[model samples]
Target: MNKKQKKMLIRILISAALLIGFNFLPFGGPLRFILYLIPYLVIGYDILIKAFKGIKNRQPFDESLLMAVATIGAIAIAIYSEVADHENGDYVEAIAVMLFYQIGEWFQSYAVGKSRRNISDLMDIRPDYANIEIGGKLEQIDPDEVEIGSVIIVQPGEKVPIDGIVIEGESTLNTSALTGESLPRDAQEGDEIISGCINMTGVLKIRTTKEFGESTVSKILDLVENASSRKSKSEDFITKFARVYTPAVVYSAIALAVLPPIVRMFVMGIPAEWGIWIYRALTFLVISCPCALVISIPLSFFAGIGGASNAGVLVKGSNYLETLSQTKCVVFDKTGTLTQGVFEVNEVHHNEMDRDDLLEYAALAESASSHPISKSLQRAYGKQIDRSRVTDIQEISGNGVMAKVDGIDVAAGNSKLMDRLGVKWIDCHRAGTIIHMAVDGRYAGHIVISDIEKPHAKEAIQLLKKAGVEKTVMLTGDSGKAAEHVAADLGIDEVHAELLPADKVSQVEALMKRNTGKGKLAFVGDGINDAPVLSRADIGIAMGAMGSDAAIEAADIVLMDDDPIKISKAIRISRKCLRIVYENIWFAIGIKLICLVLGAVGIANMWLAIFADVGVMIIAVLNAIRALFVKNL
Candidate 1:
């Protein structure tokens, strides 16, 4: 407990002791009333002052108003009946009730403060500067001042400050900050490294392709900052309920006071004291205040969102938190999502040329290229690169590289590369790109590079199923063969590939159309090419450090590190939060309504009414706090 909690705990104990003493002490009438006034002012003065302030501000219908009226009404009975702390209860009950209510409020306040602090901590991950390589020298510059196409030097042990491609040197980057993987990935010339990753080993010269604001890390932080502005369905309901409920209860308390005495005077001819029932009616007002509902419900959502943000999951609002529990189908983007979007030469086929020779010659031909597939081949070969071996290298954008390697005309890429060379090319009957290598326009061999499936990708899918996702679909712009290979490897229920960005959106729309009943559909991606699809789905989730700003902004949920298993984890957390929300809702309303009916009929006294309102509130508020520490979900 924090300082505020500690203070409130002491206040509660003091107020409890005072109430106990008043109940059991052998004090006379007037003396006991005067004695009770000491602790009453100690515990209830703040409520009284707030009530006075609200009345002055024309906002008198608040929880403090209810507390003030209830306690003062009991004191009026003490002054009039000159009663000691005898019979059913006294002002001691009133003081104790408000004191314990403060205890719940303090606990809630502390938990929310902790959660908000976590969100602030997430903002610290955003980088401040980029080391740009201007001309021959490196310079430290503000990330925003670094324009696109600038070369940046990412020395070993430094964080990559912008998304760019490697032009010189080599390194292994610990991309765990983005992808949540434990392994470090190797990157050589021509490889694209996203910003926000720490380069664990070796120096790297990267050509900044994207501006600083457009970098992956910057976008993730910005998305998290803006997530809470959007309100959820449950949040909206609570807002409207507070507005209508507070006024209605206030009016009911007025009717309870006036209606009883008027009926007795006109119909039954009894002397209408009005004070007896008016005091009961005032106690009714106190019980009906609904502060517990108003305060704890929103506090629960605030803490849930904050807790989720700390774990690197950005839930846009409490509504998404509530909807997450009802999710049935989860659609996943294959590249950079379920699979390591980084492609590597997993298998090599040397139909005639030596495998190492083919790779060395292929890397040499593609040396001048700045593409991920080319970089993977170079990294795989890891041979002493003879730059002088190649001459007249022409890089055909979106196709392949052509070069004169060791006096032989070498070309490497897709079927289009073979077609451009006017030679017969062999297709590798597998998924991923089959880079067909040709020597002097003769079909030499082919090297297939594919995005390797994530080690936890299959397990993540299994966990999603176990967590109750009915369907797991893979949607990608990759080749059908590659999509099938990845989907089969990861055990996805459906695979759709060879799609454009627009086609991915259409697929999500179709998936949403086919969803069973009112179940929600969530589209998960790295928040890059799938921005539209992510926006179209019921819930859009982005993964890792490489996620695009557009994707993160468009996505409803973002995983700070690219971990497929977090999909299940996030769903589980939401389920827990939603369960707690429902429990608070039912528990608060159920107990309050029951006690309210009993109070009106005179079967329940003001003491039980205090139990119904403030007591149930403490229990529900405590239950709502359960969502904050439930990170295990």
Candidate 2:
């Protein structure tokens, strides 16, 4: 507990003891009242002072004001009835009410602290120091002082201090803190590693690529720290509701206290019995505090955002979290979002020469270019090219490449290039790009290359369907044949093929219009071209690991590990948070309304009013804390 909570807890203990002892004393009248006043002042003097301050400041209808008035009025009534009627009255209930309210306040503070700790634990990624290799020796310095392009040595069991490429050494990094995946990832020389991953085994020599402030860890921290500033509609509604609700109930309590007594005396010709009616009104004021609904609703969203961070999903704010739960349509970019965007040579067909010779000619012809298909051919050849044997290279845009290999004119392109060469080529029946070739004016075989779907792409679509997504669409720049093949493999609902970047945005906008009512549409992408469509969607989720900076900046949610499955997880977290928010709202308002009526009618006492205010608040706070535990979900 904090120091203030500790002090309040001690005061509550002392007041409870005094209240119990004074209640059992044989003393009566003034002596009994003096003893009770000691405990009341000890437990509730701060509340009375705050109430007075609120009144002096022109904002008098807060919970403190209600608490102060309710307890003080009850005490005054007790003293008057005891002295005039020689009847015993209870002041113990007044002290007990204040004591229990303080207890509830302390519980709330503790729960908020616990929820903050969960988020702070995930933010332990900030490295204290970076070890730079200076003068052939490692020197520890502030991470901010470490300049880009400097080589930093990361030892085993240390955080990678900055984003960089591994120039030397190898290690298994534990990226669970960054990616929420428990598996250790193997990193070797030439592989790019981001900051915040712990080097689990072997020392690594990393050449820094980014400054400390621009690192992934820094960006994530900034995102989470500012998350609470953007409040959801639910939070805003509660704020406005409390503003109107608090004063409305206070005036109603006043009318209940004054109007009925006047009607009894004047209109009905009966005795007012002011003491009984006034006591009931005091109980009514105590029961009408809006503490539970005001406190628990925001706490629920904060905990939900923290829980999502723990699972490697960064929600920009509570408003996006609220919107995610209502997503009924999910649009995906085909490459790098649903498919592994890497190209590989799938097969070699229609070979007039040896298959090895066909691959060699293709690799050599495309060696001067750096397209994905070119890289795939070079990778499949698995050997360094003899550039001396090749000369007179030419690149045909939208077709392919042509070069003179071994002083022979060789052309390696698609059907268009072959048509220009007047060489008869066979169209391979396949689901990938078919590169037809001609060697020395004769038809050569074709090599097929294709982009493969991710291993979990099908499962991700299935889970989204199971999670209540009504439409799952894909937009891609690939040909109709290739796009449909991958979409069918992944069970995508619809496919918009051969689209440009602008066309992708149009497709997303059209899909968004199709979603009516409260249903929202979400777009997930990982390329730089996807930024526009991402910004146009209701929820833009980016693959942080391999995504472009523009796409990440435009997205509302980020999956740190580039996993499609976390999309469903993010939605689930948002749904759970909204569920808890609605529950607290309805539950708190329902109980308070019922008890307020009972208290005004004299069917409920001050003790029951305390339960309605503090007890319900404590229960709702505990329910809000449940949003922090999302390990299973």
RMSD of every prediction: 6.6, 3.9
Q: What is each predicted model's overall lDDT from 0 to 1?
A: 0.77, 0.87
- Model 1, span 1-633: residue lDDT tens: 678667777776787787777777665566777788877887777788999999999988777877787778767765665544354335565566576667656665765665666556534456667786567787888889888888778887788888899999988887655553457889999988788788888889888888887787777666556656776677678778987887788788778878988999998899876767777676677667676677677767766766676566777777778777789999988878887768788788877778998999899988877566778888988987788999999876445788998899988876776887788877778778678898887888888888877888999999999998999999876667888988887889999976767888888888888884869998898776677788888888887735456656777887877778888988888888777877888888888887777777667777787677767776777777777654566
lDDT of 2 by residue, 1-633 (tens): 678878988888899898888778887877888889998988889989999999999998788998998888888888888877898778877788788877787788888987888789976788999998778888999999988999999999999989999999999999888777898889999999988899999999999999999887888888888899999999999999998998998889889989999999999999998898889988898899898998899999999999998898888999999999999999999878898878899998856599989999999999998777788899999999888888999997656789999988889887878999899888777887778889999998899889978888899999998888988999987657788898888899999986768888898888877776849999999836688988999989987553145655889988887678888888888999999999999999999999988998899998899899999999999999888777788
* Model 1 quality (TM-score): 0.75
In candidate 2 the C-alpha lDDT for residue 492 amounts to 92
Model 1: how far residue 217 lies from native, Å: 8.5
Model 1 residue 488 distance off true place after TM-score fit, in angstroms: 2.3
Off by over 4 Å in 1: 1-35, 83-89, 110-228, 268-273, 306-312, 346-371, 377-428, 435-447, 546-554, 630-632
